[model samples]
Target: MSKNPLTTILEANIFNGTNYNDWLRNLKIVLDFENQTYVLDMYLPRALPEESTHEERLTFEKWHKDNRKVCSIVLASMTNDIQKQYDRHDDVRPIMPRMSQIYAVPDQHIRYAATKVFFDTKMIERSSVQEHGVKMLYLVEKLGDLKADLAKEMYIDVILQSLHPSFDSFIVNYNMNGFDKDLHELINILVQCKATIEKSAQSVLVREASTSKAKGKGARCWRRNKGKTESTTASAQSAPVAPLGMGKGKRKAVRQSLIPKDVCINCHEKGHWKRECPKLLPNQAVKLISANGLQVVNRSRRLRQTVLKFSNGRVVATLV
Candidate 1:
């Protein structure tokens, strides 16, 4: 006598009408594996004394025992209300159908709900298109289980309808060449399309960033050039008046005007007096003054003639 295999295992998962089909299918597999599926079938009719044998009696007893065991396990797994309602029944057949009819939601309700979810589903901006497509396919499966199955074409159409306007070109191209593709194929194309769009957007952002950087650099360059131009103007404004063909009194007045003001006269730079200028080296200072078309004058009392030469070979005479 082989012991029942199901008795050795842990209790099966409780069945509520919610996942009745799956639970029932698993239970059937367990029963079949144990060679006790006869428990689910109708009981045999009573045998006459003349027709009955010892082996037949034992077989019937074993079948009845196995049937009672299966029923008890199923009842134990149910919720309180369902357990109480079905607990009195010792046979599997009556309990199975009654529980199914009482607990399972109507196919019409499931179909309507599934259809609503399928059509209302849209790809959110933050969510990947693949994830949205997956959710849509799951809803389609729910509809299929409720006997409202959609064809491949209908599935594609629903997904396309749910897409946002950004995907219009993808939708159009998909429609042109996607007649023979399945659900997963369509999802793959949408995913690729999404990646392409993102890549293009990233490229645009990079280009904009480059353009902004260039504009910033140009602005900085302009500011630098403007500062140089302003410094040149200030230097020219503070320049000494030329002493060409002027009298001693006029030369003295021009010398007074050439005295250092706010910035160095030699370098024309701020933050120091002309005598303290870093570029006031004997050779460099003369070259800088000559470059600016200016000449140095000494304040000696002797009437010595000093000649100042310019880059264009023009000479100016000043008396000191």
Candidate 2:
């Protein structure tokens, strides 16, 4: 293939079909691609071996050794074009050790200006909760006692705006129902503010599941060994662990009474349930009367007697 001097290095096999990041990583080692016309002040300074971890230092050393003939070496410092105020020397010192094990030290901040960003599904699932949680918690902690809904909304918006390209992808295969639509809409609304709804929701459910399982297993095991000699002795020796924060005012949930399947409230029949009742109320006198044959009867006295007997289930004797 016919190629110009500027484009000759682009043909190098290092970039064979790899993604943007992988291609950049491979090409950086195999070829010197920096243009002589570009000024150093325009570009952000690269981290030096002295401040970087062992692996990073090694990588930097290797890159310099390979490209020493073409590119000049410069230390990352306060003089460099800092993308953020927090990107200063002292601020990044605590995070340097993590570079030994990590492949990339990506700045995850949601910057107002254009900057480098990337995303992967694996990272989304793994650190989505922690990263977003930290952001939300930081905001909430900073705001302290201010309205939670407002704080959450603001935080979620920040996170959504800060989303890496990969996380913004939409999968159209799944068919969502009304409930799913509502939850997703809520999550999206929250996501727009900076709060991680999905991760936080998942974490809460997982926590409850684990706690419930543990309690169930403990109760089952305890019951199984209730009469055993070792368990009896252990129980007798150890002091009981009292429940925390439980008080007389705190009420436990009462399970709802089950509806009888074969009973009908409308018909007073024993075939179907109250929920399936289809009868409509008839328009009649509110009070039913046994006025077929009456011999000078007092309505109020009779009504009082009927009410007393119906309420107490007792028939009082009357002198004739």
Residue-wise C-alpha lDDT for candidate 1, range 164-256, written one tens digit per residue: 788999878867874678788888888998899999999999999999999999999999999999999999788766657999888886776
TM-score of 1: 0.56
- How many backbone collisions does model 1 have? 0
* TM-score of each candidate structure, all chains considered together: 0.56, 0.16
Total backbone collisions for each predicted model? 0, 12
Q: Model 1 misses residue 155 by how many Å?
A: 2.2
Q: Which ten residues in a row have the lowest lDDT in candidate 1?
A: 294-303
Which residue segments of model 2 deviate by more than 4 Å? 1-170, 173-190, 193-196, 199-320
Task: Quote the lDDT for 30 in model 1.
Answer: 67
Mind giving the per-residue lDDT tens digits that candidate 2 earns over 143-242? 3333223434444444444444434532221122222333235445435433454566779999999999999999989877875867778875773433
Quote the lDDT for 281 in model 2: 25
Clashing pairs in 1: none
